[model samples]
Target: MSQQRHELLPTETHDELARESFVQALKSHIATRVSPGVREIYDHRVRDRWVSEHGAEPADRHEVREALSADTYYRLWSSVRRSSQHLLWSSVGDAVTRQADDLAARARVADAGLGTLRLDPDLEIPWYNAEVDIHAMPGGYRGEYMAGDVSVGAVYDRGVYVYAMGQMGALNDDYGHSICQNLLAASYPEFTPRRILDMGCTVGNSTLPYVDAFPDAEVHGIDLGAPVVRYAHARAESLGRAVHFSQQNAECTDFPDGHFDLIVSHIVLHEMSPAALRRTLAECRRLLAAGGLMVHADFAGYAGVDPVTQAMIDWDTYNNHEPFWGPMRDMDLVADAVSAGFDDGAVSIETVLTGRVLQTGKQQRAGQLTLLVGQA
Candidate 1:
């Protein structure tokens, strides 16, 4: 199913919609039909060859990667997955390009006078973001083609739905909603934040949920992309949610120290390089008020996970242009948080099921997210 489009979303024509639907079905078929075969081939062919040559099962994900790298079936699966990622962007890009000017106009008019949009054209684009198109998106997240280019943001807003195979819910905000409702509310019921900040908030999909979760709290979201923040501000306005959106690097921002009572980020950690991530964590600590909480959530961690599973997760590092994905997973997030100035006892790395599972055909995959949480 397509997302429930708001005023800022590009209007798709019949043929564009059909192409997007086709791409979604292709992705679903690949996930359910083709992906499972990789495991089967590994078990029957790759593992057997490894045991015969090494005299023992593969010791770690590195060995698994070495063995799988030579296998034809694994390569095929990886190629297909990479192709689908490209197709996802291309399909969505068509609609966005056709209506780019109109969409920008709509965003300008859709402002409900509820929130604010702050952009800095001179803000430096970090090397990690400027280096490659993360997740194979054509323009990455910050590409601007025209004067008021919200095209890339629009592509991402819709592409995420098709990429996740519609598991992220109507607004693709399940990660934000799940953490707020299932994790934070249950873990700290009495805590009510006066000021909340979301870092690396691309298009505010995850940012707007905080407004609903804490209606009276001041909500602010910051990203490095002007187009993304612009679209996010308009989207929030159209949805009748008051959310402040700004284009600012998470590593260093204009906000004063200890300005936020609650700081959060959804699926943002892995996108950053180690140095940047370390700085961002320290900045999170610096921005957090006394007794305030900080939470950074992303895909499952690699610790204690089997070599084959690790290999599967690490696939993104090589094929998906996410050079930092594997290393980030292996890092000691709890230790990192402590090093960032949080009390050692107040920080922890934990995994929780979001219960937002998506079923494609006969396959059932777990919806798991890992969190690095700290309290100052």
Candidate 2:
């Protein structure tokens, strides 16, 4: 007799097939666009020029092209992977835009929100402040600024919209939710959260997953970007999820002491300097009730991974304008969490999808570590 099949097998098999097709389509699209002339110019003008002037090592243009193609494929696949459930939810995107416009209008007349802040000169913060053009989006966060004036934010918003289209009906947050949900179910089954906070929740990509995972909890998402928070709130509301989106810095949230049952951040730490990271950790600790858990999902150091994978991961830091990523990877997360007053044993690191306890202190020497989950 044939072996019994798991109930999830059919769906899993279909998903894998869909992912494979999407990857192939992405690869074909990239290959077709990367004409020989374009490749030559990118190689000679960009790669070779940087190598000679900056003393950066030269990577073969063909190899780099192949890598770029692969990266594009993976990014596209990952984007749609998590949103498979809502892939048919067509109306949510429209709802998000409509809600955003309403919220933006409300924020303009109000004394608070992104409309009031003065840009810090020392921070070199790239987003706009006074007018509704956080990051130069027209009507900035308030959507009052004209699109022509806020070109940067407009382009950014367009990119997000385009990506969301590809996501079908999935929540707009990072693919982290599905991955984290599976991981928690398999690895940490003992914890049941009552209240959850997602930090640096730009546009709510990582925040909505917690709501799905812990249906009973009040999910709150905070970010420093006003426009992003407004945009995120609208998106969440459109999806019919009750997520409270607020504009607040992760370094010092205004929440009262020990109010949250779970605190999480995804792909947030690398953007900060060491000092900011410390403050964020302190804030996370302060917000967690006793026995509450804190989990951060971010990249791990390339300390122990195979050499090739490590190099590929490290390349992203410089090539993608993620200047602080390398430094954060080098920093010891365990030590950082311990310093914030969590007991050593109470803090643990694991993979968010696999439920595997990551070998802490083991660096991915060659390849970049994918995801690290730190608990406090």
Question: Which one wins on TM-score?
Answer: 1
lDDT of 2 by residue, 155-264 (tens): 23333333333341233343445445556666778878888888877666567777778888888887665556655555555455677766677777678999898888
Every model's TM-score: 0.96, 0.58
Which portions of model 2 show Cα errors greater than 4 Å?
Answer: 1-169, 306-309, 354-376
lDDT of 1 by residue, 195-266 (tens): 999999999999988999999999999998888888999888988999999999999989999999999999
Query: What are the RMSDs of all candidates, in order?
Result: 1.6, 11.8
Question: What shift in Å separates residue 375 of candidate 1 from its native position after superposition?
Answer: 0.4
- Candidate 1 segments exceeding 4 Å error: 51-56, 358-365
* Sequence-dependent TM-score of model 2: 0.58
lDDT of 1 at 306: 88
* C-alpha lDDT score of every prediction, in listed order: 0.88, 0.52
